[model samples]
Target: MWSTKQLADLAGTTTKAIRYYHRAQLLDEPERGHNGYKQYRAQHLLQLLRIRRLTELGLSPASAASALENDNSSELYEALTAAERELTAAIDKFNAMREDVRGALAGRSFGDLALQLSDKPPGLSEKDFAVLLVMSRLFDAETVLTFQEILHSSPRTPVDEAFDALSPNADRKEREAVAEMLAEQTRTRTPENPPYSTRGQGLAEAVEIMEKSIAHLYNDAQIEAIRRSWELLRAQKTASDT
Candidate 1:
C-alpha cells in the first residue's frame, strides 16, 4: 500500500493531477485505513499510469477514460484514431503559422498576402496592416489577390506619401489637393470589380464593415482622400461600362 503522494511519485505525476483524476472519476478513490489515511494499492498506481499514458498520447481526459474503459475493443481503437487525427491536424496548422511568421520576418512575398505582411510599411502604419488582415477574412482568395495586384501596380507620388502622414488637423487646401491628386491617380488605373461589389445582398454589409474599419484607422484628411478617389473611380468605371 502507498500514500497518495507516494503513488503520484511512483507514477511520475503530480499529486494535484492524481487528485484531479479522482475528482474526474477517471481514477477510483481508495478507502481510508483504520488510521484514517487513504491507502493506495498497486491497482490504483496502474490505473493512474494508464490514464497518464493515454493523455500523453493526446487523448483528452474524457476520451482517455473512455479508451481505458473500452480497452482491447473497437471503441478504444476508434478513440485512439480520432485523437491521432486531431493531433496531426494541430501539427499541420502550427507548421503553417510558423512558415507565415518566418516569411514575414524575412520580408518575402508569398502567394498568400497575409503571410507577407511586414512589421510596418515605410509610409503606412499598423492600422493599414490591420485593415488588410480584416479584408483577407472577409474576401475570397481570388479577390484578395486582385487587390494585391492593384496595390502593387498603382503609381505612388510624393503627394501620396504626404497624405499618409496627414493629421486630422490638416487644412482644407491640403486635404483638397491630396484628394484631387489621389482621384486623378485612381482614375488612370483600372481594377477588377471587387467580389463584395458584385454581391447584391452582401455588398451593403461588406461596405459597412470596410468603412467602419477605415474610419477607425484613418484621420479625417486621409479618409476624405480615400472617399474622393473612390468616387472618381466609380464614375470612371461607370463610363467605361457604357
Candidate 2:
C-alpha cells in the first residue's frame, strides 16, 4: 500500500494528476487506512502509468479510458491513427503560416493574399486591398488567383485614374463617361468564360457580402461609379446576345 504522494512519485506523475484521474474515474478509488487517509496499491500505480502512456501518445482521457476498458488492440490503433492525422494537419497549417511570415519579411505586400499572386500591381489603394481581401474570402483560391492574374496583366489607364479621383459631387455626365470607360475596360480584359460562376448555391449570399464590403470600403462616388459600370456591362452583354 502507498499514499497518494508516494503513488504519484512512483508513477512519475503529480499528485494533482492522480487526483484528476480519480475525479475522471480513470483510476479506481483506493482503500482508506486507519487514519482515514487514502491508500493506493500497486494495481493503482500500474493503471496510472498505463493512462499516462496513452495520454503521452496523444489519446484523450476519455479515449484512454475506453482503450483500457476494452481489450481490443484495433480500438487503440484507431485512436492513434486519428491523433496522427490531427497532428499532420496542425503541422501543415503552421508551416503555411511560417511561409507567409517569411514572405512578409521579404517586403511582399498583402501577407497571405500576396502569396497567391505572381506579382503585386502598383496603385492599389488600401480600400482596394480591403475589397480584394473580402473577395478572396467570398471566392475560392483558384478564382482569386485567376483574378489576380487579370489585375497584374491589365495596366491602369487614365480613365481608371479619373474614376479613382472622382469627387462625391461629380455630375451625372462625368460619372456616366467614367462608367462607360470602365465597362469597356472590363469587357476587353475579362475572359469570355470567367472562373467565378454565379450559378452556385451561395451566389446570392456571396454577392451580398461583396456589396456590403464595397459599400463599407469605397466613397459614395466610387460606389456609384462601380454600380453604373456593372449596369453598363450587363446591358452590353444583353445587347450582344440579342
lDDT of each: 0.62, 0.67
* lDDT for each residue of candidate 1 in 137-208, tens digit (9 for 90 to 100): 455545555655556555667766878887899888888788878777655544445443322337446655
Residue 47 Cα positional deviation in candidate 2, in Å, after optimal superposition: 44
| Top-scoring candidate (lDDT) | 2
Could you tell me the TM-score of candidate 2?
A: 0.48
Give candidate 2 regions above 4 Å deviation.
1-84, 87-124, 198-205
Clash count per candidate:
0, 0
Per-residue lDDT of model 2, residues 45-157, tens digit only: 55776677567546689998998788556786677566655554566554544443334334553433342322235655545544554565567556665666677667778
User: What's the CA RMSD for each of the models?
Assistant: 19.7, 21.5
* Ten contiguous residues minimizing lDDT sum, candidate 1: 113-122
Model 1 scores a TM of 0.43
